[model samples]
Target: SAVISQKPSRDICQRGTSLTIQCQVDSQVTMMFWYRQQPGQSLTLIATANQGSEATYESGFVIDKFPISRPNLTFSTLTVSNMSPEDSSIYLCSVHGQDQETQYFGPGTRLLVL
Candidate 1:
């Protein structure tokens, strides 16, 4: 299993601002995904960050609003741009485990836009 960690575990930001959340993994991983969990909703897939390619965003997510960077197998960053109250949520990063089907998630970055 790989150990995952996220920066800025919690933050309160002003509306219209942007925050960049960093995700780091102890071991190399081929599949890394970003997810968002709203207050009372289940986790929603944001995008998939592949090391050498542009991130593939999920249906409702656009690259312009949520830009992702996967510089290497063990590190990725997700930026919430022009954030608003509606964007306030718990952002998580996950990496596929050895079994591929399994995934390990980081603590998550909780953002509160006011």
Candidate 2:
């Protein structure tokens, strides 16, 4: 099992500003995924950050807008660039467990762009 944690549990940012959220895990993990959960909506896969490789983003999410960094096996960061009001959402960090089937999520970083 991996213990995951995210920085700045919550934040309020101005439109056009960018915020970088950090995710740290207690143990090394192979696959780390980023997700966004909008108000009253289900989680949407944002991207997957694999250590030593570029992050693979899902449909509708561009690297330019959502840059991800996987500096090591136990750490990753997701930056929301040029944020707008519509970008207000709860961002989560998840890592695959030992079995690779189960995933553990971190306390999300909530962002509200005004």
Candidate 3:
């Protein structure tokens, strides 16, 4: 099982700005990822945060737009840069559970670009 150690669960940001959402797991885990959920939509995988290397972003996503950092086993952060109205969404930080098959997600940061 994993627990998120950060709060402020959500926030609203202005356009052309950026927000960094952090995730911390209770135990050391190997895999951590960032996801985005648009209004009334499903989750989209943004990237896989590698512990010591650059994050592996999904097809439509890019590192320059969504930079991720995983400094250690249990901590990571994802920054959504140059925000726009289209970028307004719920950003989530997740981790593969200890069992591996399951995944746990943080409460998520809700950003609204104005």
Candidate 4:
């Protein structure tokens, strides 16, 4: 079993602002996934965090918009570079499950960019 933790459970930010969310895991994982869940939409994978290498981002995401950092095996961070009301969503950090390879998510950082 793998356990993950996220900081800033919820935050309300002003427009044109940005926030950085952190994720920490109890064990080393091969790949850590970051997701953004907008209201009423399915989970969208933002990127895959690979240790010692650059993060692999999804099609709609760009490095300048969402910069990811995985400095070590057990830790990583995601920064939302720009702010907008549209950026308001639930940002989650997850790890692959040990047995089934299913991804397990964090409690989520609820962001509201006003």
- Worst 10-residue lDDT window for candidate 1 reads 96-105
In model 2, what lDDT does residue 70 have? 92
Q: Per-residue lDDT of 1-114 in model 4, one digit per residue for the tens?
A: 677899989999998777999999999887899999999998999999999999999999999999999999899999997789999999999998877478899889999998
**Please, what are the lDDT tens digits per residue for candidate 3 over residues 55-82?**
8989999989998889999899888899
In model 1, what are the clashing residue pairs, if there are any? none
TM, every model: 0.98, 0.98, 0.93, 0.95
What total of clashing residue pairs does each candidate reach?
A: 0, 0, 0, 0
Model 1 TM-score (2 dp)? 0.98
In model 4, pairs of residues that clash are: none
Compared with the true structure, all predictions reach lDDT values of 0.96, 0.96, 0.85, 0.92
Model 1, residue 9: distance off in Å is 0.3
- Please state the error at residue 85 of candidate 2 in Å: 0.3
Candidate 1 deviates by what RMSD? 0.5
lDDT at residue 108 of model 4 (Cα atoms): 93
In model 2, the clashing pairs are: none
Tens-digit lDDT string for candidate 1 (27-110): 999879999999999999999999999999999999999999999989999999999999999999999989999888999999
| lDDT for predicted candidate 3 compared with the true structure | 0.85
Angstrom error at residue 21, model 1: 0.2
